[model samples]
Target: MLARAINYAQNQRSYMENYLLDGRCSISNNAAERAVKSYVMVNFLFHDTVKGAKASAIVYTLAETAKANGLNIRLYLETVMTKMLDYKNEPDSILEELMPWSEAMQKSCGLNNGTI
Candidate 1:
């Protein structure tokens, strides 16, 4: 058992060394674990099929990205959906304006506007 443990540690030594070389490298994945915890719980509670789960994952990711960008989640989603309808037949490049980081979206849906 001790020999197996030592072999495992030796195999992982390079990874540990990399962590030591980077000050910003986390020793554990707790932040990533916490980020996915809600999605896991929501999948169990709300998703009934694989298709539903995939759709939920996309929406959840968009909402999280919007929140991280300081945009009001509800307003940002609403604006994007509404705008998408108008641009559905247009070129995909036009959709860039609908992103949370876009100047127009920031002005309309950003937290600084007291919309949140």
Candidate 2:
């Protein structure tokens, strides 16, 4: 089972490496590994059930991504959650707004202050 899982992951990685794909890259997923380590730390400390672990992982990933983008973590999250609650809609498409590369944030503080 473990071997099959590894092979499946390799195949998926290869598929994602297609040059024409917008975010495709022929590289190991080390960045994602490091990003998930925060959730792993929480799991190690609390040993929560799968549902709680998943929720923590999602929130950690968002916060970490915000930090990576050079945004103030607390402010970014507050702004995002406020907008999300105001919209009262699923936020799948709005994830881009949370990213540091968005012009909305750049215009607020300019490039230097905004570059994470």
Candidate 2's TM-score reads 0.63
> Please, what is the TM-score per model?
0.67, 0.63
- Give the runs in model 1 whose Cα sits over 4 Å from its true position: 1-33
Candidate that would win on lDDT: 1
Q: Candidate 1 lDDT, tens digit per residue, 24-83?
A: 778886765787797787665877899988887788777887887899999999998888
Model 2 score (lDDT): 0.67
Clashing pairs in 1: none
Quantify all predictions' global Cα lDDT against the true fold. 0.86, 0.67
